[model samples]
Target chain A: MANKVLVLGEVREGALRNVSFEAIAAAKQIADGEVVGVLLGDSVANLAGELIAYGADRVVTVEHPHLKSYTSDGYSQAFLAVCEQEKPEGIILGHTSLGKDLSPKLASRLNSGLISDVTEIEGAGEDAVFIRPIYSGKAFEKVKIKEGIVFATIRPNNIKPLEKNASLTGDVASISVDVQNLRTIIKDVVRKASTGVDLSEAKIVVAGGRGVKSAEGFEPLKELANLLGGAVGASRGACDADYCDYSLQIGQTGKVVTPDLYIAAGISGAIQHLAGMSNSKVIVAINKDPEANIFKVADYGIVGDLFEVVPMLIEEFKALKVNS
Target chain B: MNIFVLVKRTFDTEEKIVISNGKIQEDGAEFIINPYDEYAIEEAIQVRDAKGGKVTVLTIGGEDAEKQLRTALAMGADEAVLINTEDDLDELDQYSAAYILAEYLKDKEVDLILAGNVAIDGGTGQVGPRVADLLGINYVTTITDLEIDGTNVKIVRDIEGDSEIIETSLPLLVTAQQGLNEPRYPSLPGIMKAKKKPLAELELDDLDIDEDDVEVKIEIVDIYLPPQKAAGRVLEGELSQQVKELVNLLHSEAKVV
Candidate 1:
């Protein structure tokens, strides 16, 4: 009999995060038997059909009130139960904030090996090898499970999601686990996140730096990001300069992103800032300083004041969108 | 109130990675306390100061790691511990690292534990949460702010770009985020004091564990740097012409538009 693979379909704001489908897609590439999708939330049974259509052979939902907001205690209890019951040969989850926090605990509890932030997978079934970024994407390491179950976390936007096949559907089963003694309780969630696309998952990002002189300086970057339907980010210099909140910071000690198009405006790229975004697919730099390090990593560079270049580029992008 | 901070010595982020023989060459690499752990140590010190307790800095490495531990002590940690795994294990993974740390901690009187959100070298933010799971305690990762009153604690953790306020209690573990606190440098007086501070070193044999107990589960098949994106074209012209050229290039060559 072939081994069964379990895919954790992570839900956020009532919908399954895109990385969930990407994980299911990854599980399909590795599964020799049935690929099971597991959903955990207070009300997530309704989201199971999409997982099935995306490639899950079956869906399991663990519903409990305490599971609504993510607490390691509650989620681990619920997921561990499904793992024991199903005895899955493999487990896959998204390497998001939730996955990063949850997977290690689950992997530890199961006494299983975990390959995290995997950007690529090779081979199939037990022979599969996982490729993950080490040293903050400075280097790549190809790892494999020497023994025991295959457990891994895929970085968001790195892997491709399987296309939906509406003709494909499966049964969605519900299970209950006793969730108590949670040492941590969420009091509230304060959202300072920009209403724009999630930066990590965004296809394009317009990032600013110290040259963005003031808090109001980010407004133009935000406008450019909005025009491109992308997200706005900042270098630590900009964040440190108080031009923007630390939430928008990207660099060595900040969020690492691999957006399709990273437009760096007025940012003299430091190695620290480059550490977070050097992996971006197509980097474009608009800086007045021709000698800026950002130009070295960029696919294209424009030497000019960002105040003038950004607006002109935004207009040009607008025209291109119209023509398309 | 007894606080513990987990520290690891890692390559400085500024250093260019030099890999040879499929392994990161560390012969002369400058190492420092993992930057995020500095935040953890700072937080531990502040928590200890306010709540009337001592902070113990703990790390799992060889004798060389004692320098980082002493640095933590100089930053105000009450004591330091170095679990010398050099002779016992050739390589350490997150699983074994967590297992050994948990085993050592399982017997201690721990009121609070802290660690960096992620190590700069490994870049895996797993040890703190895994240790917490092994010890069967609650944990919050990437915490930006923490408040404690009696046995109750409130934390603000960074979830991507947003914040989640959580209520928890001791004994709890939290992984420090970047903005958690400003880590203090070791003062000359503090450095002198750290010389007298206790730094307890132990080995796997002392912990009653062997090679098979906490074996590494994941095997690294290969290690190499990603192909660096070569420097591309730098457009030159009037502002408007440059904008037009960039748009054309993004569309025709890049196709990312």
Candidate 2:
């Protein structure tokens, strides 16, 4: 029998998170039997077609008013009930904030082993081997679970998301959740209002370090990111000094990003920072220092002041836009 | 509130890494308590001092890691427990280590458990949650700030730049991040006092876990150095010319323009 892989679809503001698609894409490659996705929200059934488009064969929707806001107990209970019924061969989830909090509890309830932040997964013998970064992305360790069920939490951006196939068909199953187990309640949710692009999911990331010199220096990076329809990122140093928004910081202590293209502006690459985004497909470094460590790993290096280089690049791009 | 902080000894971040024959060479390197775990120890001390409770530090490593256990004691843990095993066995992943630690804590009085978000060396960020699962406790990761009130713990964590405040009952697990607290350096008297503090050493047999159940299922095939990075092209010209050249490179060559 082919192994069944169940993915816990994460939702934010009543919408599917990008990582959810990434997980489904991964499941499509690793699972041989079926792909079932469990989603929890007040009215998440509406997103069923979206999940199917992303590769889920069946979408399980657990709806409850209490779940309108993300309460750990409520979300976990809903998913747990589904697991009890499905008894999937393997379970997958995003290693995001919500998934991190809930996956352990679910695993504990099922008394199963969990491999979190897995970078890759492949079949091995009766079970699957999960690969994860060890020693701070310095090495990879392949872990195999010799137990009843295989459980994994995948890091965001580790897999390329699959494109939606127009003919994909999905069946939406609505289920009710037990609200009694929910102990905590969310009073309010405050979102960072300035930008729509999430740095972790952006394909093109423009990151600045302390080399930017000042907070105002990020204006051009932001403009360029806007022009490219991507997001801005920053090194830990720039975030510590308040030169850029803390949300943009990328490193071991901050968000880990693996975008298609990563541009490091005015940043001397530190090991901690490099660990987060070194997996990016293409890296571009712009630093005045000829010996900046970033250039050592960057695919393209421009040794010059970012203030002078960034504005001119922006102007040239704008001219290209006008011409074409 | 009773708190237990877990610490791991790993290669220091500043140490220059060299890959020899596809394995890390550590002939002359120094190891220390993972920087993130120090925050866990510090938070445990602060919470214990404020609420009048006991803090026990736990670890699973080789005999040499005893130095880190002593350092945790010097940093103010009331007691320390070392789950000693073969030095080569220390290569066990976080899931294996967490299983051993959780099995040990199963018999102890533990109301709250703390750990770094992830070890600096491993950077896996999975141990805390895996341990919490093993212990059957609620788990919170990447906590930036925490406040304890009676049996309830309120925490604020950044989720992709948006902060979310999560409230959970006591006896839960929390993994500390870098900004949670500044780990205090052991004072002279503290170091002197820590030398005399009791360090309890326990073996896997002491924890009474079945070694057969935790056998190595996954074996590493090899570890190799990533390919050498390609040298970058230095775009030459005045600032304007350089910008135009960059635009051309991006459009014609790099193709990300």
Candidate 3:
């Protein structure tokens, strides 16, 4: 075995996403030898040192001018060049929008197979088993790579990144590839800018459903979310009812979140909705219906009207903060 | 213009998965066109209507898939193709499925291809890009909006919740994300018209593709349901007291606050 593993560090808006470090942690778990990190973009040289602090044995960067924004065509060319240069036996990437789009093309170019969105890895080296959710977290499967390279895309917020050790350092190597023939162009961007927190990575989530009544009904939930420094989420019911944009939808067809604290107000736990959030660490369900399916999975259930209960909880939380 | 949409028949988004004897029990399961694929199909038909082209819905499955193909036709697709894989193969991972689809599409003058961002059953979101790579075409994924004029194309892709505007050209493959467009239901007249729509069925031999060349590369070791959550505790008594207790519990017991 070549025993070298390659991990792709994802950079969004000039900063390294937490999952990039997490991918390095996961790569170290599955690699028997050196865990090398790869960065692509116009100016990602500064991030190589960050990767080294989090356990990357060395860093390889491709700083092509065309690699400023993520184009599948551009990234595939840059990454494939790195693969040829390194010839790593294993590869790890975050299963974000970029990885989901890029890894498949790279796998096809490599004549390899991919295990996408893996949540856990067991054992080390080629014999490692990757566990991934299927059927929107209702079921899980254990998969193993059977041919070519050990390629996998890991979901964010699952693997813990190696602790930052400023004392640790590694070599940084910059490489170049001819990135041309780009068929896609980036014209503009529209950022949601609703909350600073990304929903999938939020530690606490304040979510609403049809019981929130209307778009204005989400105001309180948003207030509480702002107070708690969390993100706002909505069930498919809320989105379909036109109360909120589908971008806020959280369910089987929407974003899947595993926050530490999930306060679901008026959201009857539809199977699809549960599949997205049932993994939250501490679920608090406030619904008028005592038998709302959410209560089944929640750690604490308040059988009352959310409009009333949520306000009171907010006040009480605030009071607690004051008294402390 | 030539446009193709890759469709898959999957368990309904609301259907509860039942695993029996180490396998997903599919008997009596209500299957529908993958919800995301519906977004792709609707976009395909809309593109064809604007650009003057044929919209073909293609899938790889058994005869049972004809029902889905008919559904696509009823939704305004001009034609359908079912590459039946039941007899020649038993299982399909992303790699083999992409291989088979690319094999069938290799000879066609493919201008644009649309597929769901991710199939709910597998949720890998791999096949479309894989097919594009195998055929040497450009691709984009999770596109919420698309526009075409002559050979020039533009797209709005969803990133987390933000939107990125992109420009591209034809001979492209794009995977549809949500909010592309509101999918239209198959009308009664459309269903009637679909009965007469062309649906061609082929096999591995039909494409001169050796089944051995498309062997699955990954092995599924096991499948099981996630652990069941313990029944929750429903608070009783006064509203403020309940609020007080809940806040205290979240702070002291769960340590999440």
Candidate 4:
């Protein structure tokens, strides 16, 4: 029998993020018998019942007042202690900023190998192979880890989350964590404050570029995004020129996203920008320029000014929703 | 602040990669400084210019890596150091390589050490932080913005869809992300100066690093090209028909819609 696969559950404000369930779904395909999920945080222990519903045979809860707020040292030390006890074959972590900080430290301490930002996983018996992009998402590399223990940090929105089972059961084990010895402290955290939608996890995204003309030009695109219940993204050009916030920029030099539906509004997609979001399920490009490279990959392209087309799209979506 | 920027010579991403057996085949690909490291070198030069100090660009690669060293010099680094070892640097694991560099830097009065967040070639963002941990200096990765005021450094990191600001003391190790600064091209005079500037060559034995200090943990069993793309379907007929066909293909075949 092989070692059980473990997933590090990620949650914010009590609700589980999509990446947590996706990690479990991925673990199920790779592990033979049991898939264990580890939940860390205060008052986050109750989420374990939800974890079993997502397909975990066991849930390890690390409950500490210090764990309530994420400190790099606390999380790493706690996770390291968990690995010491469980001795699982592999651990899965989401490739968010937190995971990026925690994974390498954990891998270093365990003397284990980590495959970062993995897009796919395949397992045959005890051998689990991971596929990830290299050269800044220009190409993909499949790495086989045949060492002591394997660790992987998966990119969010890349994997599909499994449906909730609702009939599963699992034991919740709590591990104690010490609060002292955390070196780097986060002085301040500034959130965007808008609850419109999380672009990072959204299945659908409508992106604008410099071609949108001005900040006001984004209004129709925002309406379209709202109608679709998605988030609005932007190209580097749009962000650099102050057409939108830098948070929305998507490119090799910016945020990498892979959504189910990616609609480009007046965006002459540069290759660097495309490299980030090219893995999207369906790309619909709307630009007046017929020669835009975005049309090369777009499943449906509209060659017209976004000002004319986007408003019609919002109106059409509203009518369709009302009719349905 | 006296800064040192570490760079690696890697294959350009523009070239089509060909992998054979378990290694990346370099039959016809032209290698250059990993693109992200350029940002680190640029930031180092900027710091030196502002603070009135020298910036040294260091690398542990083959003789041909000198071009990238000269490029770094041309970009405004005052000096260059190359650990001219016979070992294939790509084959040499990062721990051993960083250990060698750390041993070398112990002698220099380095106030700051900068590196690319991750080498595009290896795609491992481990070296900077791992080296920091080994040296026991504070390490900050994925730094989008950096400010040096006296000795206190302000590092702005992009967290989960947000930014976290952290303040730490100097003599720190930072891994710079893209957009930290725009890299400068070598001026004609800068290129001429690079030619005259001395780039010292050293051996693995020259450095005081102990061989046993570097513990190699990870072994890459194999590396291969990703699967080939299937031929894409072109929806033909009228605009509405094409849209309908594309929608069907997306919802049913892709299954992600």
Candidate 5:
């Protein structure tokens, strides 16, 4: 059966996040029918053109004062209203903070099946299979929805967005939704110092482990990351030792990241830590110990003190940019 | 106050996952109570100790899961319950699991329920919120600190890089985050006490839920290991030379720079 798939566009700081476009790409794969983009936030109607430029056939806008900030209750109620009216056969959303909080609740309310953090989609129609990581990244599971609506959240950077066509246009329709009696409310969103790139969505990530020694040791890694237009991460050991904040930790208990390039500096790759970043396209490990387990998974290994090696590499990169 | 902590038995995080014939090989593998759920269990015990309540650890699994329930009991839960689904079900998903749990708790006098932010194995982070939704109760996820006073609850939840403070009333559910508390190890005495503690085993019939009503919505089509990473090219020589070679490879080979 041809399925109308709804892609929920995510907005941050009044602009569409990159994952929104990535979600449109994922929705295009599952959607044999119309691909509709659903935008829910204050003044989100103007963002529909961007979704249309990617791949959405039409856009549905739900703007309300209550949805200015993302609260699970409020977003779920708004999304559920959109689902009820559209009765989409499938739903695709970014596997982000907002998606993680709202997808499960919406799926439960609709009695639908959900595959969260899906990295790939295979087949089509009723036979469509969604692939997601299990046991962290140690294993992958391909799941299918047996009945009801097919709901899935796509991890950012895994699915490439469709090329933009400025000529393409879609009908933008406004919908009235009654968002009321929310059990939870977001009085305000306290954003951390806004970095250029989201660590989870960055194309390149430079991570430090216990060998970084102290919080100050992260300076070189941060410099390399900044040069590469990326973000910085840390292992649980670094965070546990108070070398870095838990927010920067990437491991079994921390945020799972899959970037195009991952540089592990002074990290003795523990299984818990490998569970998070082993999926990166290219992994580079820098450690003085040649026998370090991180080398087992890295594409490139450098056996040297990160302090000396990192500064040298940074200088080399700088020289390359200047010469080019 | 009456507290419940939901626990699950998962493969040890350190165990190398092996998949055979499209399923995880479990024979001879070590299993432990999910590490995150340990934090939930510990938090429940502390709450019970301070607020004058009993903590009951619950799990929905087969007979093998009793070990995990016992571990939770050993960690200081006052009671334990194992909702055995071995005979009646072939598959289970988050929705079905939450449905069964909500049905069981709907009639119980529950003030607060605690669960891990996400099971390490599935990593979905869905069950706690789904159960709260099913029971029509308020819930907070990834909570680092929780304090209860009378009927009001104050919670600090992790939000990526920051934290958010929320205020709500009782009949609440919260998922324990990493920084919540240090989980206590099972002492010898605690282990012996756990062996004698009341561990009740119930079935779908006991919870008044039918097998069909709680049927799994999603189907597992295949399970397999991720593609293996190739052996790394270990760059040798002095620090400067290694750095030179690394940058050269990053530019020409990996094309990353």
Candidate 6:
């Protein structure tokens, strides 16, 4: 049976988030019929062309006054309406804060199954299997929907977006939605000071652990991250020690990140911490301890004081960039 | 006020997992009440203590899970319940788990229910909200702070790097996040009291849920360890030399530069 998979495009700060394109890429694998992108928010119609360029075959825009900001109730109601109208066989969304909050409600309302934070997809058609980290990335599980609409939220940065084709065009249809009786209202969204890149979506991440010593120890890591156009993260040790905020903690209890390149500075690889970043394409560990667990998972291990090593690498990177 | 906390038995976060024949090896693995769920249990105890209520911890698992339920009780819960599904069901997914939980909770006078933001083993973070949806109540996840005053609830929920303040009525559910509070260790007296606390073991038949109605909607196809990365190349020499060599490798081999 041909499956029309709906890709939910996420918009943040008047722009399409990278995960929107990544979800479209994931949808392509299971979509045998049409890859339809569903955009819900005020003034989202303009983003349809971007979704199409990233691989959506068609776009459905749900615009309403109440839909301007994200509330679980509003998005759920709008998304449920789209699902009912389109009758999609599958729905793919980014495993983001918005998606995490909305997907479960929608799934329950639709009485469907959902696999969250899926990192890989194998096979295709009705038998499409999803690979997700379970036991906190210590192990992986392959799961399949038994019946009803197939719903999944892909972890960002894991799925590469399809090649963009500017020539590709798709029909954009606007639908009116009634988003009322919301129990929760988003009066405002206070984002953390824009740190250039989203930690979860950054291509490269420079993370620190307790060995960073103090809050000031993060300065070098931050500088290196900023230079590389990446993000800075911390281990639970650092967060617990008050070296950094819990928001930057990456571990079993914190955010799970999988970047193209992961730099663990002064982080001893606890299983909890590894659960968050072990899947990074290439791991580089810089620690004074040669036997640090982080080295077990790293592709390159530098047994030296990160304070001395990080500054040196920063200079070399600067020179390398200038030469290039 | 009647407070309920949903707990799960998961592998200790520090345990090194071993997969044999496509399944996690659990013969000697240590099982603990999920660390996140401990936050829920502690929060439930605090809420009950602050505002006159009885805290009851619940779990849907085998008899072995009684150990975890006991731990919750030892942490100050007034009662515990184990909905044993060991014999009736071979597999339990989030949907089925939520269905069973909702069925059990639907008739109860639930003022507030708490659970972890996500279980480490499954990490779906779906059960609490799914149960809320089924019971037609307001719910929130990743809550860092929760305050209740005579049916009016105020909460601060974690959203990525930021936080959101939400106000809702009672008869609510919230999943506990890491920053919610530091969970307390069970005292010797609390452990002794937990031994005599009401620990009821029920089954699917007791909940009046038919086997077919609560069937799992998803199937696990395989379980395996992630492919191991090749051993790391340790750069030998002084700090400066290692940094120089590391940058060279990043540029020439890793191509990350």
DockQ of each: 0.83, 0.46, 0.79, 0.37, 0.67, 0.72
How accurate locally is residue A262 in candidate 5, as Cα lDDT from 0 to 100? 96
Candidate 3 vs candidate 5, TM-score winner: 3
Worst 10 residues of 5 chain A by lDDT: A186-195
Roughly what TM-score does model 4 have, to 2 decimal places?
Answer: 0.87
What is candidate 2's CA lDDT for residue B145? 80
Summarize candidate 3's per-residue lDDT along A46-137 as a digit string, tens digits.
Answer: 99999999999999999998999999889999999999999989999999989999999999999888999998888777678999999888
Clashing residue pairs, candidate 4?
none
Evaluate residue A270 in candidate 1 and report its C-alpha lDDT on the 0 to 100 scale: 91
Q: Give me the displacement of residue B136 in model 5, in angstroms.
A: 0.9
Off by over 4 Å in 6: A193-196
Give TM-scores of the second chain, every candidate: 0.98, 0.92, 0.98, 0.92, 0.97, 0.97
lDDT of 6 at A208: 96
Q: What TM-score do all the candidates reach, one by one? A: 0.98, 0.91, 0.98, 0.87, 0.97, 0.97
lDDT of 2 by residue, A89-201 (tens): 87889978777667766765666667778777666435456777666565566666655566778888776678977589978887776766655545445576235687767
Model 4: which docking level applies? acceptable
Per-model C-alpha RMSD: 1.3, 2.7, 1.4, 3.5, 1.6, 1.4
lDDT of 2: 0.78
Which residue pairs in candidate 5 collide? none
Which regions of candidate 3 fall more than 4 Å away from where they truly are? A319-324
For each of the candidates, give the backbone clash count: 0, 4, 0, 0, 0, 0
lDDT for each residue of candidate 5 in A1-324, tens digit (9 for 90 to 100): 437999999998789988889988888887778999999998899899999999999999899988887777778888888888898988999988778878888888988778899998888666678999999888999998888888899888898999999799999998898877766655444555224578889999999999999989999998998888888899999989988877788988888999989999999999999999999998999998988999999999998889988888799989888877
Over B139-220, each residue of candidate 6 has an lDDT whose tens digit, in order, gives 8889888999999888888888777888777899899988899999999998999899999999999998899988889989
Docking class of 1: high
Candidate 2, residue B136: the lDDT equals: 63
Candidate 3 colliding pairs: none
Residue A296: error of model 6 in Å?
Answer: 1.3
Comparing candidate 1 with candidate 4, which one achieves the higher DockQ? 1
Q: Which predicted model would earn the best DockQ?
A: 1
Q: Calculate candidate 3's fnat.
A: 0.84
The lDDT ranking, best first, is: 3, 1, 6, 5, 2, 4
Q: List the residue pairs that clash in candidate 1.
A: none
